[model samples]
Target: MASTVSIGNGYGQLLRTRGAWTYLLPGFAARQPFAMLTISIVLLVQHTTGSYGAAGAVAAVTGVSMALFAPWSGRLADRHGQRAVLIPGVLGHTASGLTLTALALAHAPLWALFAAAVPTGASVPHIGPMVRARWGVTLKGSPLLTTAAAFESVTDELTFVVGPLLATALCTTVNPAAGLVTEASLTLLGGLLFAARKSTQPPVAAAGHARVEHASALRVPGVRVLIVAFLGIGSVFGGMQVSLAAFTESLGEPGLNGVLYGTFAAGNMLSGLVCGALAWRTAPQQRLVVGYGALALTASGLWAAHSVLVLAGLGLLVGMCIAPALITGYTLVESLVPAGARTEAFTWLTGAVALGQAAAVTAAGQLEDHLWGGSGFLVPMGGTLLALATLLALRSRLAVRPRSRTVARGVGHRVPVAVD
Candidate 1:
């Protein structure tokens, strides 16, 4: 009871931090587009081109672009500042998103769509990672750092729950282009707003290090393992987005896609809240393995779900398994990498998920196109099992090194991390 009360108080204290709400609201809005992008692309492209394969391919292009470039953006932010990186990013993303929406609506060539998608994906502001970095800066030496991580994880899960449903509703009820239009508008407005709150932003990590050699976050062994594990989680997300859409469309109830997917995301949000509220006795490493094992077990049942009801139930179970792994993975980052490379480390993990989601979307789309929706479900099961095996084999790499430095304080302490 005391632990629970302290956890609750931790949240209360965090919210009470001066100027915290200023950036948090805008950050929340800016990051919603991340959740909306793939679904919006899948819906819009599939609507125009009439092929899930084409839709997936176009979306994959954007995902691949983002995955390739996000770390570079993070590195730049670490060297320069968040404002410098964000100004161009939000502007470019808005312009590119609008262009892609126009080309798709105009029935432009596949190459044209693919070309526009590059900048659209690459310029995503990564506001989640930025926000978490801000928390690290603000709560550097406080025990509230872990609480902040949990809060941010819950926020991210909430976005997943809301963003997709909003996009789906706009696409189905208003027009196919509405979702994309809103996404761009929100990106432009919210990104700028978040960027404007410069007070909360972390200072450039490289400011004092004149010509100092900075190491890449990729050099960390644990980061590589988490990236691979997150790839499996991404597969589930990508597979569910495409497969759920295809399944519902075949039933002649396309709107149900949002409802079912929302249910799945709701489970994720619920688990995040529960995970955050608990006073954990087990190590995050142990939690990670257990979480992933449950995820794989739940995913194995997806291929067997033929009805909407069955799929929703299995998806909820699958969703429930994700937060523990994700929360644990991000928490692991603090123990794994140095403070100077923290943003880049966060982005690398984010990029891995994007890359994995892109691959899974393409593969699942192909499977659904040539085979059946049931076959589409196979991708998640296969991807998770394969990645889970690698995680088991490489689990030793995730252990904390004896030489430690706290990311924010320069003192040695384990602070939990989270994403947008």
Candidate 2:
């Protein structure tokens, strides 16, 4: 009877955690644009410019810009609060998307497309980090925080799954610009809805506060290690995306790319949901190591896949480790950073992933152009292996425990205790 009760409680944690679903749903909506933007840009640019190299360059530039700005954006949110930072950011990002779409439809110059892409990327609202920060504030000191992290990871996987499929369908059916337009609309609408929820927003830190005296989250001992590891993981995602697209085109079925990528995310979503529900005694670092190992093992199989079916099957296995790893990483970040720095900390992590992805995408694009077929898979394989190595090397530093104190001194308020 005790075991049954514990199992039921574990699965019911998400529902039991008040306001989790409320914030999480809009967060999921806001994040759809992130998943859709890359593919949409690629399709739009490729169609207009008639060169995969140019398309890849534009996508890489956009990713790099977003990565470069994410931590700064997060810092602003930390100081000024979510609505203050996100509302303007979302508006600028949406406007940039509209500009890009117009440029693409008008058959503008390559330089014009690249020019418009900068603001689109720079204005990305770092919604993922903000959402996770809210979770930290809401569920502090509870075991259920882990479950919330898992749910967020599943939300990410689901968004990536749906976003890509939706973008592909729009691009294929309506027009190349349709996906970008849709992405802009979603970003504007969802960002406003998410920001309007005043009850759930985490409080801003006071200006010139001494709590902000501590150096950035980058200086936190374990954070740099996790950021580096996440960079590697991001490379795996970026490389896989480019490689899979190229692989499908080579197979004479370019449309299958979205379905194959969605299948990958589907595997991630399934594992994340299951991992979140079960109670685990293992330390997050141990789980992280195991996750990286799984990713490396599965990703290495890509080199051997000669058939589309085999590649799709391998994609599912490779993706299974993604959510578990990401969930563990974010949970660790929550435990490590001070309350005042949580949003910035999470954004830095997001930026690391973007940096890794940008680098890998550029490299994979080049490899696809020059190397033999399927050789591009090596980029992600190498990245996962590097991530595994980093985790193993820094295992000791990441051993910090979750703080149990309830007062959120950094945010100048108390996080309400979760009531069953």
Candidate 3:
């Protein structure tokens, strides 16, 4: 509790430097509630239709829509902004949700799946990365942005962990249709609030260089490398969810599954908060390396724990490192990126995470089919992830080229690096 307080104080001080904390509050509140609703929508659709196939189609279409259009949508956000870009995206999602409820209830198929998911695809994600970039631009050199990233990670973990559970409760206890309606209303309301705010608008790129700038942003070596890293990390974490499911069921403690998962999440939350609070001297690059290295180490440690309790505890410890690392990674994307690409940059970060998580879950499930149980399944799985993380960390210098190296050649002064 003391540590949490300390962290909050540190974060508050950092935000004070910008004097724009209030400006971001509305966006933050709006974002998390919408995420909860999105998850609920998936669960509700599955329940109402009584077909996992229909449900899966919805999830797939929604996911694919985001992956395909995220970069471009982000580009739009960067160009047109919160009012023009984000609001339209939000409106699309809201209208789609309303229409989909009717179409789904009517038993529409095929093209309807695409139609229903289009709006969910088009909307900007919860404002985590964009907010970080805005802070980076407005409060240049202040640590407030990193602290905000930490806070964003906290909300992310919480929203994901709590969201499905809340959905399940609503569907099972109340009318399933009501649950869907609740989800729709929340998403529409929250997103509208987010776009309506003035400060929520992201920073602008310099004049006459928007299109050329967006293209060049992709060409950035640092961006490409970071994306690769995101893929590996996201895949592993995503797969771990699947692995956990297999492990609990195989251990003949299916009831313990939720408990184990809860602990895993608790660990992530604790670690993220603690790490974010620590006033570190390490460069963001070094912090990023340390962050991944911690995950790799924890992966192996998790494999070694013999019981659920021990594993849960270690998972929490490992999770502590996750948010700070993510914060560092997002900061890297924000710093090296040009002004025009902030929206796109944030989306790329999230999309990378989404891609990795999706791949990991699929691969893990396949691997589990060939294994005895989850315990047997996760060992090899953890090993693979740990090895990859280690390799990436070792080669990070090559993969993540710091800006300072260039500064040394061009100027005598040390160039600032924002990653750790």
Candidate 4:
């Protein structure tokens, strides 16, 4: 628990954080479209190639490349601030995407295609990492932290919900490569917007290098555990990306793919809103465990839904857990990490999830194509269940056990974290 002053159960503390919301607007706008581009790239390539395995390979390459670069990018951002790092990254992403799009249209060779994937992965800015790092710095232990996190989560879910559907429509009904053009243009615009703002500047340490407390955050046990947890989270998302769309098409209802995806995203957005509105009332670890449990149950229940309507409703229920777990994990990072390493900490968390999503998509892409598309969803569901089980088992290991930590803080008494 934050052990901080409690306002009456509303997130009034968040609402009162005057300058907070506006600073985030540009970021939300930029990310909303970028997140959609990820799906657009994945589905467009998969559909165009008629090979899920090929699509997964490309996605995997993207994930691996991005994951490899993410930590270093964060470190650079921390050292040089957002302008120095993000602008170049945004340009890099735009150039790379445009090059690849042009090359694809020209019917380029496979070698160039694979080469282009490297930039595609490398140029993708570490937005989640940077945004969260900014939140950690500005909000400290306030409700603004929770709200910012929830806000990001909602944007994340909503972006995927709306972004993909729009991209899909453009690809199917308009131009097969229309989404690529949009992705590139938005990357430039968003990256430029992020760079334009003076107030939203990222922090840099005195050392002028983001190395001081950086490595230590990586070594934290809980951090590692949480990172591992997101592996399943990534798989869930990856599976959903391919399978949900494919399943709808398989059922001879290709149009419903958009509805299903939108519904799933809606579920996540709704939950993020609900979770954000609730006052912080539970321990981060406890909240995380419960969130994963609910997520697992939702994932499992999704498998048994008998119809699209039932599936959509159940998917919404499952999506509800997305933001809460992330919010809880982020809080834990802030609670446990040294201030100096916050950027790196945030980077690892976001990058790790990205990597997981990439890996899941790569790992399961073939299976979905060769076997049952619905079968792919099982991978994520299983991963979420396993993640839930691991979290439960690690409870004793990670839990603060009231007396031990509270005794350290010497807070004499414990306060109930109120909801409602």
Largest lDDT belongs to which candidate?
1
The superposed Cα distance between candidate 2 and the true structure at residue 76, in angstroms, equals: 1.0
Name the candidate, 2 or 3, with the larger lDDT value: 2
Candidate 4 residue 357 Cα shift, in angstroms, is 1.4
lDDT of 4 by residue, 1-420 (tens): 434344334355654565556555656656643456556666667666776677677766777777777777877776678778888888888888877677666767656756887888887876666677766766766647767777667767777787778777776677767877787787778767877765756556665333433344565557677877776777777777777766776788866877787887787888777777766667778889988888887887665565788878877777777768877777777665556556767777777777877877766777777775566677678878878888887765455432211112123543221110
Q: Each prediction's Cα lDDT score?
A: 0.85, 0.80, 0.57, 0.69
Candidate 2 lDDT, tens digit per residue, 1-420? Answer: 001124356657656667767766777788976788887887788778776566777888888888889988887787788999999999999999899889888988889888998999999877888887887778778777877788778888899899988997898678988899999988998898899887889886555552442246665668888988888878877787778777888888878889988999899999888787766678888888887888889987887788988988999998887888888999888777777777888888888888787777777877877888777788888888988898899888788755543323343544321121
Better of 3 and 4 by TM-score: 4
- Tell me the alpha-carbon RMSD of every candidate: 4.5, 4.9, 5.9, 6.2
- Candidate 3 lDDT, 175-250, residue by residue in tens: 5555456655666676666666666355555556554454534545556656655665555455445555455655
Candidate 4, run of 10 with poorest lDDT: 402-411
lDDT of 1 by residue, 92-183 (tens): 99999999999999999999999999999999888888888888888877777767777888888888888889999999999999889999
Candidate 1 segments whose C-alpha is farther than 4 A from its true place: 1-7, 206-213, 404-420
What is the Cα-based TM-score of model 2? Answer: 0.91
Q: What is the lDDT of residue 395 in candidate 1?
A: 90
TM-score of 3: 0.75
How many clashing pairs per prediction, in order? 0, 0, 6, 1
lDDT of 3 at 128: 59
Most TM-score-accurate candidate: 1
Q: Candidate order by TM-score, highest to lowest?
A: 1, 2, 4, 3
